[model samples]
Target: MVTEVRGFTDPQKEEYFRKRFRDEEQASRIISHIKKARSLHIMCHIPVFCWITATVLEDVLETREGGQLPQTLTEMYIHFLVVQAKVKKVKYDGGAETDPHWSPESRKMIKSLGKLAFDQLQKGNLIFYESDLTECGIDIRAASVYSGVFTQIFKEERGLYQDKVFCFIHLSVQEFLAALHVHLTFINSGLNLLEEQQTSSQTEEHFYQSAVNKALQSPNGHLDLFLRFLLGFSLQTNQTLLRGLLTQTGSSSLTNQETVQYIKMELSENLSAEKSINLIHCLNELNDRSLVEEIQQHRTSGSLSTGKLSPAQCSALVFILLSSEEDLDEFDFKKYSASEEALLRMLPVVKASNKALLSSCNVSEEGCEKLLSAVSSQSCSLRELDLSTNSLKASAVKLLSAAVESPHAKLNVLRLNICELSEGNCEALSSVLSSQSSSLTELDLSIRKLQDSGVKRLSAGLQRLNCKLNTLRLSGCNLSERSCEALCSVLSSQCSSLRELDLSNSDLQDSGVKLLSAGLKSSQCAVETLSLSGCLITEEGCTSLASALSSNPSHLRELDLSYNHPGDSGMKLLSAGLKEPGWRLDTLRSRMFPEGPGGSSVASLLFAAGPPPVCCDLHRPSPTLLISAVSAPWGLVP
Candidate 1:
């Protein structure tokens, strides 16, 4: 069972084997046997011809240095590869397999010997078993030197075909390396969006250890280089692993300032602020009170108070710190004690940066007011404002609207989500938006009770505003089909440059979706990403959406109909469009039951269900729209 095979190198021996393989109709038998051999730590399913060539070379090396080969074929394979890359006119011969450098028969015999050796190793899973090459008649000193050179060669060709067996234990020949290679290629090339499979901390640690082992084994005395490579790979594969650890584990691994700097240096190129935000959420879960104390205790705490903040909390605080106005009454005065003062002192650095965080902070009304006052200075350098989920009512909007016209209005984003804005606040905000001096790029008005009337008033300003507003979120604004029509009309007109729209959880039915679909057909419309999650849509709406998508397939990049009741018929309609190669829609899924695994099947089930009350007419647009052009004729313009 533990047979060491020597590959046949003689032309006659090759012919015999080839003829025998042909007779048996086994084109891959020999290569398969070699791969199944357990001596190789890294298995690359090379072409059969390559394997034959490798077998010949491995045989020649063994004969020249009789009974003196590395213990693990992993070590010997690496040694052989180095020899192949460096040497020319390799010669070997056995009576059965021959090469010019050895007798034809001698080369054949050596090749057979090599095959037998590999087979023997495979039978026993010898690579995992063997550690000391000296016991196996290998020159340890020479093998060690050869390993260094071999590692260098391996690194140079790391891109060709990775030895993933060492990287992941689950790798099997059943799994296609080329397919995985293509995936990693796509990711490295940045051609497609790739999401990492979420894994638990223990799993990640296990994988990390494996990665370390692989890197260490990659080359001799190049552990640092291997570590650097692993770091880059880990970031690419699932940077969240590192970020999650930092967040959930607190500041244990990164307590040393040097270590923090090293992590920052390692991740600086690709660690985005968004990743930082996730880190912050994790850190927030960990008690940052110690960090708070640490900040208070430090002499130069101002410059390093941020050190008290984990990478995640620091990322989250970017919003709180930069947007806090000097005159605001809401921000806890106590919070402003030492750390806040230190952050304010660093305002110059913050203001100079282009990054801004858009999130809802659940601070009290007084805290919001205090925050506004603090940031409401001539010297205040707030570039973006997000008062979403705060009590920024009509009065607050009116006051902030003045800041929109201020000479130092560095504001490019404003979020007023769930701020309970009525028509009065809508009008006030719209007036500021319509102003010639407005520098806003994104505005979020979700869950703000923007009924038909308030929406209608805002529509007027939207039509007049010349600013480059790209994203508008009005989810749960009590918008009926008519309100969607109004927004659709604005989006369809020349006045809109909106690239993203989120009407999620808006209670809109098929009629609203249809109205919006028709608007998308208009040549002037530029909306690219659309989210209608939780909207009540039926099969009819899917048909309408398919038509809209067909009208302009290139513009849309992402569309989310998640949580919508689009049953089988609707899913079929959408799937037809999604399968199109020209359409920019990269992801599509739905949740009809709100409990089942969300997928196309669920989407189909949702639409198969009857249309909601808002789509009572099924054919007619909802009556909520003040604009009349959308309802007439009963169908979208083709």
Candidate 2:
């Protein structure tokens, strides 16, 4: 059987908690104060959160006369951390007076635990084993003595082999410990060696500059939240609480000043939007209200023009503006200026954004090279890219193909339509399509000059076992019968993953259709949609298509033979295939011939089998004709 526990507001539960405090009045005051903080009050609904709140509030009440209490999540955690430290130190000293910060054993345990946490966090592992603790110089026996600190933030579990496994209670707790490790390591090092070599102010400056550089160098944003916590811990109030718990020195004015300058310099040098946004968060934690306001003002003042700002500067400006808004996904570059600077600024945005649109941006080979370089970075997050209507050539295509092949790239949709591609471009693109790491699923190369040789190269890629391209658009690329033959081989191959093929408005004729039909008849062909619009196919080609359509368990669902002269004889053969029990073709479209016996007879035969379960469009007289079998069926009659 299962039982449900009542919430904090339950009278019996409230009475029980009130007794845990010194008096009922103290409990009431603490509860009243927490209720004033809207966010904190909601968190109190969790029993663990309520317990932490009560503990911190009780300490604040006992320590001084009307002292300021923790109001935010970070402040509350810091207070709880200090309380745990004091309790642990008292137990370790066995009733003797001792400073926790100065205790050798306490310092050793903190350092060891912090190092273990930092290393595991980098590996993206939250759970640890007995071996991991031993490797970090942490004895299992000592870990039990520090159970109060560890148990508050980490949960210990028994493994199947009777060994111990440990994980943080929350991810934020791990981040906090990692930040504390960096801070104490630097400050402790400075006190030991730098103080003898230079003044205390100089040592503090060195510590701040070193820490800032270390945090900024991490491109993956792994150190983001940790850096923010480090800055927050630099506050005087937080430092006071940590004085005897972790550190002996107060917060340094020099460290704060140096940190601000170092961060600004790093922001100006790097063009990553993710890194810049993290730096801003750290600045907020430092409580430098003026610097944050100045950066925001600079972005909104419109002084940072595409032509005037450098790439790094433009990236910083754009990131600052975008982070101020709530829904970043809605931000578009529709009206953005088509300049090198603008494209460069978008590089960082593309690396962090899920969708990127740079259509009609007048991008050239140089811009393509830079953009590809950004996409191939270790921190790239782009999944879709649109460079349509650009002027990319073979060199740009090669660069882009290399980027797509990078293991770090996550691009799934790529559109380079009307980009002036050539046979050489196709060769480069084919290499990307064949790469095992390539993530491309949709490719558009329409309206460019990719003749027989280009299509042949792309077909070679399609036949590769590793190629996973599902949708391909190669319309109006001057392809011939030879190109169709190459694509036919891809469809006939058992390893092919191609699903949709569009060869519309090309130079292909009846011979090309006949060649494609041979592959379509193969059981290995998985294509579902085939568009051969305006390929000059005649009745002879339709006979071959009919044979393929009647093959056992056909995969074709939609066929377009429109804008071609596939006369009455062609329709009769296609109608016969539609009547076959094994045929899966559901939609067929063909252009209307002149008003003769051929046109009427073909139309009647299409519906002769009691209006077959397929939608057929035979355009006649008007170009915009609608003969509906399904809902909202409209067709173009050319």
The candidate scoring highest on lDDT is: 2
lDDT of 2 by residue, 20-92 (tens): 7868778887766665443356446567667777778777788765888776555777787766666665665
Q: Which is the leading candidate under TM-score?
A: 2
* Model 1 error, position 338 (Å): 14
Q: List where candidate 1 sits over 4 angstroms from the true fold.
A: 1-379, 594-638
Tens-digit lDDT track for model 1 on 386-500? 5666656566677777767555566777878878678888788778667776777788898767887787777777777474678888877878788877887777778777898
At residue 156, candidate 1 shows an lDDT of: 17
Give per-candidate clash totals: 71, 0
RMSD of each: 23.8, 10.9
